[model samples]
Target: MHQVYVLKRPHVDEFLRRMGELFECVLFTASLSKYADPVADLLDKWGAFRARLFRESCVFHRGNYVKDLSRLGRDMNKLVIVDNSPASYIFHPDNAVPIASWFDDMSDRELLDLLPFFERLSKEDDIYTMLQEHKSS
Candidate 1:
């Protein structure tokens, strides 16, 4: 048997709780369901994710597993993806909020810092416009 230990990101619970309240949050990952689902279940205690999408949901392009967000059947203008890997959202960079990948940095507050921005984002009509403005600023 193989046991794995997962560390929750700082303020991730708060982040998920708040994001759940404001948006129809979905857990989308390129990892296989067998691995990611259990971790998500452990991390998401508040039932934050309305849906969970696994590796099969991704589109493999140029040797990378790209999350083709258009397949999600949602309004593109309202869609937003928060991910650490740029390649994951290469197909829809306009809708993505690129985050730095986490790995054993206990002092990291990226998720916490994003709360206010996400709160503001929840009110915007066009996510692309807001993201573009955020990128420029």
Candidate 2:
């Protein structure tokens, strides 16, 4: 149950960085088609730092919406998709929990609260344990 955090905005980086301090992070950055060479150059420079932060991280340069979304959901069932707008378009179908936060309005404490559930799902045996607990209750 490796938790994959899909970050969609530039401003969300700060919050993502804070989360990385506590969890194993796999960051998904939007494509750089609009920015072209400049964006590519920046990613090349930033690649090293991104690599060091996680067990693995990748840049999705192709904005194949349907394909990427399908892959993301398949890769990890336990995901926290963070976005600045209503993510109902994406999360509604997958049953993923979306956390909406504006750059100026978001708080670190609020993000930290979700860590426990994310960590629990990342464990292989937690599903059965959770079911057992649920049945007993």
Candidate 3:
């Protein structure tokens, strides 16, 4: 058995709260349920997330965990995935925003920094087009 240190990203609480206000927030991670659940419960103490998906939800693609947003039971046109790695969203690149990976970096503000952009996206009728524009910019 191995122990893992689950570090909550900085400003994650505020970020999740803000996201919850604008969208139906969901927690999707490649971590195992045993590992990710407690961390998520702690981070989402205010119940920001509407749903949760764990490692089983991801596909083992080419030695990597790939998160296909199409499986979320929601309309793909309205979905955007904020992942730390672009590889995770290779299945649907147009709906991806590659945030910087945070490995216990207290100074990292990637999630917080994205508030303005995400806020704009919240107003967009089609998240796919906005994500595409973001990728090209």
Candidate 4:
């Protein structure tokens, strides 16, 4: 493949579809747009993400890239970020839902494991408080 190619994580489309039904999903990554945009298209061909943010949105802090969710123009209490990298959500630990890094794990069901919680979480009055109480890292 001379062109860059991306493989969709197993069941990720279903996961995104499920999450999309509950909340306004957003794609926030530290990857440069040139690379990330195409990957995003493949990952979200169903158009699950309500917004997409790229590397410019990241903050270079302490030699690690940090995603500042505060700039998302939304209430911090109602926001959640699921990422494999701790550095991505270091600025808002309470809002982070950590996942083990996956590489060619075709049988992975990490996304499925999260569905029930998100289903319940969408109804909560405050996500931040709920996340603190649940704290699954």
TM-score of each: 0.96, 0.39, 0.89, 0.92
Clashing pairs in 4: none
On residues 1-137, what C-alpha lDDT tens digit does candidate 4 reach at each position?
33887776787888999988899888999999888888888788678899999989999999888999999999888889999999999999888988888889899998888888888899999787667766744
C-alpha RMSD (angstroms) for model 1 = 0.9
Give the runs in model 3 whose Cα sits over 4 Å from its true position.
1-4
The per-model lDDT (C-alpha) reads 0.92, 0.39, 0.85, 0.87
- Segments in model 1 whose C-alpha atoms lie over 4 Å from true places: none
Q: Which candidate is the best by TM-score?
A: 1
- Which residue pairs of candidate 3 clash? none
Query: Residue 92 lDDT in model 2?
Result: 29
Arrange candidates by lDDT, descending: 1, 4, 3, 2
Model 2 residue runs over 4 Å out of place are 1-24, 31-67, 72-80, 84-92, 106-108, 124-137
By summed lDDT, which 10 consecutive residues of candidate 3 come out lowest? 1-10
Summed backbone clashes in each candidate are 0, 1, 0, 0
Clashes in model 2: which pairs? Answer: 1-122
Top model number, lDDT: 1
Which digits, one per residue and each the tens of the lDDT, describe model 3 over residues 25-73? 8888888999888788888867888999998999999998988888998
What's the best-to-worst order under TM-score? 1, 4, 3, 2
Q: How high is the lDDT of residue 123 in model 1?
A: 88
